[model samples]
Target: MTSLNVTTTTLYMARTISLCFLVALMEGLDLQASGIAAQGMAAAFQLDKLHMGWVFSAGIFGLLPGAFLGGLLADRIGRKRVLMASVALFGLFSLVTAMAWDFNSLMIARCLTGVGLGAALPNLIALTSEVAGLRLRGTAVSLMYCGVPLGAALAASIGIAELAGGGWQVVFYVGGVVPLLIVPLLGLYLPESAQFRNARESAPTGVVRGLFREGAALPTLMIWVSYFFTLMVVYILINWLPSLLVGQGFSGRQASWVMLALQFGAAFGTLSLGWVMDRLPAWALSALIYVGILGSLIALGLASRWESMLAAGFVAGFFATGGQCVLYVLAPHFYRPTIRATGVGSAVAIGRLGAMSGPLVAGKMLALGTGTTGVMMASAPGIVIAALAMFYLSVRRNGAQID
Candidate 1:
């Protein structure tokens, strides 16, 4: 490429990456914030682990509609406006959540925050894919997603420190405050996805129905199933692994440290996946990751020991999270600019149901007296099914259409 082309690419990539990173950061904060605060909330409210899971799951539940509505809103109005609105809403809910005195109140606040989380994700992914060149789109999008793991890691580290000092309430306070600080920067620096801008005039009003009109039904369904299954398993790991480890005889501090390792491993997995995606099909790459997840989960179940548990945690993080990164990268290609936001948002929204289900499943597993091995193994079917669905939908098999 010419110097001018290189410069433009560099600048655009930076902007895209920044937006994605921030979105991922916000998502990480939103999801992990509650996890960080779990113990504190439990003590303050005199609750059990299952109830605490509800608090964590509430935000995810809210994300379901937030993803759809945010995408639709972005399609009708614009990505920039939707982004600003969601960020503001998230900050507001985070603030409210910090002030909440009871389980019910906190649940309501978390649900609202979930909406913001859901709304922000699809548009952010769309933005990254839009600005990236076609050749580098997968890698660029994957790199942008690194923000998720980094944000989660930040949450874990900060959460541990704050909880140590001021208790879990401090974790919520930090979650509420930090995003508000980023709000000014987001307003000043974030730009609309270039593709969204170009397609604004031609975009449709009805997001869901419009997605299915042009032979989009089958592909859309496949994407939804594949995305949903993968995320359900991934969210389960994120929400319960630490506590599960505690059940396996590790100390609470050690469990938290293990969780940190998982998140960090996820960060590396995303970066590596991005690089590999440049040379492979996104679906195929995802399939490979899912296979790894199945293997890891089975091994984790059979380990019956600490060193093996730690090793399993790392591999599960690598496969489960790394696979989800592919869906985010592949999202932009599934729709034209006119409805790209809606498509991506709709996919995320649908997938959020699985995200919601993940913890619920884990909760049920815990209730059933299932051991650590059973809990970890439960994720395998979701991964395998999603992989099969995706392989069937690939362009390689049937001349499939992405947009």
Candidate 2:
């Protein structure tokens, strides 16, 4: 590339990544806001563990269709258009969430909010990866995706502030308003993916089929499995960890701090590991992370002190949450530009099933008398499964040097 070309491309990539950061930041904040507010929500609605699980599941349930259909629509329409719409959808529903007066109302609002979020993520990953180009792609995409953990961390900061007088509605209100403000700016500044614009073929149906085609089959299947398992453990922590900590005798502020620690670790891990992923054997890198994941889960279960649990939560976030971020980083390479969003979307759509089911499963197990330690120990297998799936994909199919 010529010097001028390099300069222009550099500017373009930075601009795109900046927008992705904002969008991802908003998404991270909104998604975790409910969790940060979970205790208050349960109290306000007189909800038990089972009921809270349902509320979490309800929002995740909406994510399923949003991911699948949003990807398809983004392919048919345009990434910029679809992404702008996705933000609008979620922002509107978040305001509705803040307005919710009862359990059912909250559930419905959250579900709709999830739909917008689910659609936005795959596109953000796909677009960021494509725009970053081949060199530094993994690291760039991973860095952009850091908005999620940072956003979650921001929510935890709010919890630490203890500002709402134990009320949770203000979080949603802020979440909703920020996006609404950004919508116009996104239109003005966020360009569509150059790759998507160049290759906007009308092949939405074929794209789904492309995932199952000969060369793509095993990698696609393995990626889906990895995403499902990785996301399962992630959502479980996001939905239940605070409440579980409370049940274990920690104050709400303490639980929030622990959650913040986790997100801080995840944010650090996502950025740090991306550089490693760019240079290391993909499987070896994943295995290294999963070992930490597995070890942390064990530590978390065994720890008796709050400080120890906090430390374990950070380690778990480093591997588990950061591991999931890598999956997003790796996904676009598995398909052509036309179907990249679809492929990522399908993975997330299936993974949403795992995310939705996690809380419900935990709730059922807890209701049936499973202790928090037992519940966490059981979750360890999910990280194991995710590692195995990633190993299979990385070594068997994805190549030592991921494209």
Candidate 3:
């Protein structure tokens, strides 16, 4: 390529990643909003743990179809269009969540908000991977994903600040409005995927057959396994950690601090681990992330002191969220551009099942008097399974590269 071409490609990649990062930021904030607002939301709606669990699960359930349909649509229409629509949908519902008058209304709003949030993710991953190409895919995706944690941290800060006179609705209000503001910017500046456009003339593959056919079956299954378990742990922590901390005798303010630390750790982990993923051996990276997750979970369960819990939260966020980023990075390698979003979306949709299950399970365990330790310990076996599956994928990926 000429210097001019190289410069243009660089510019395009920068633009795409930057805009995607902004969207990821809003997505992250909204994902964590319910958790941050849980206490107030529960009190406002007169909800118990089981009811809260349903509330959490309701939003996650929307993610399942959103991811699949979003990716499918991106392949047929375009990534940029699907992403913008997803953002607008989530933003609108987030506002509705703030204005919710009853439990049913709240659940309905969150579920719709979740659909938008879920749809945005696959396109974000697909767009980042395509623009960065094979070489910088990990770094670029990680960099974009870092927005999630930072945005979560911002939400935590809002919680800590007791914004809008500490009204829980304030967080939702912010989450809703900012994404709407971003929609026009995306429409004006975000470029469609060059790879997707280039591949448009080729015969499209059947969605199911595309994912399962050829040599993709095993990798697809493995990715699903890893995503399911990894996200289960991540979502459990994201949605439950604050409440768990409060249950353990800490003040809500203290829990917010720990949550903030966790988000900061997540941002750092996402960026650092993503860079390492490109340079480190896949098996080694897999080992590092899972081991960190296990250790963090143990520490979180055992820690009693406020400082110790904060530290544990940081470590948990680092490995759990970072490991999730690894899965997102690896997914694009298994499919061509024609179905890349479909493949990633399918895996993400499967992961959402895990995500939905985790909070409800924890809610049940807590209601049954099992406590935080039991919840943390129960997650261990799944992490081990996820580790082994990821190890297999890492080994397989070493010998395979997609254009």
Candidate RMSDs in Å, in order, are 2.3, 1.8, 1.1
Under the 3 Å rule for N, CA and C atoms, how many clashes does model 1 have?
Answer: 0
lDDT score for candidate 1 against the true structure:
0.77
* Candidate maximizing lDDT: 3
> Any residue pairs clashing in model 1, and if so which?
none
Q: Candidate 1, residues 260-335: lDDT per residue as tens digits?
A: 7777878888888767765677466756887888887787667666767677777877777877887776666667
**Alpha-carbon shift of residue 343 in model 2 (angstroms):** 0.3
Q: After superposition, how far is residue 110 of candidate 1 from its true place, in Å?
A: 0.9
**TM-score of each prediction:** 0.93, 0.96, 0.98
lDDT of each: 0.77, 0.84, 0.93
Residue 71 lDDT in candidate 3: 92
In angstroms, what RMSD does candidate 2 have relative to the true structure?
Answer: 1.8
Instruction: Encode model 2's per-residue lDDT on 27-130: one tens digit a residue.
Output: 98887887888887888889988998899888899889999888878777878888888999999999998789998899999999999999998888877888
Cα TM-score of candidate 2: 0.96
Minimal lDDT window, size 10, model 2: 394-403
How far residue 401's Cα lies from its native spot in candidate 1, in Å, is 7.3
Worst 10 residues of 1 by lDDT: 394-403
Cα error, residue 293 of model 2, in Å, equals: 1.3
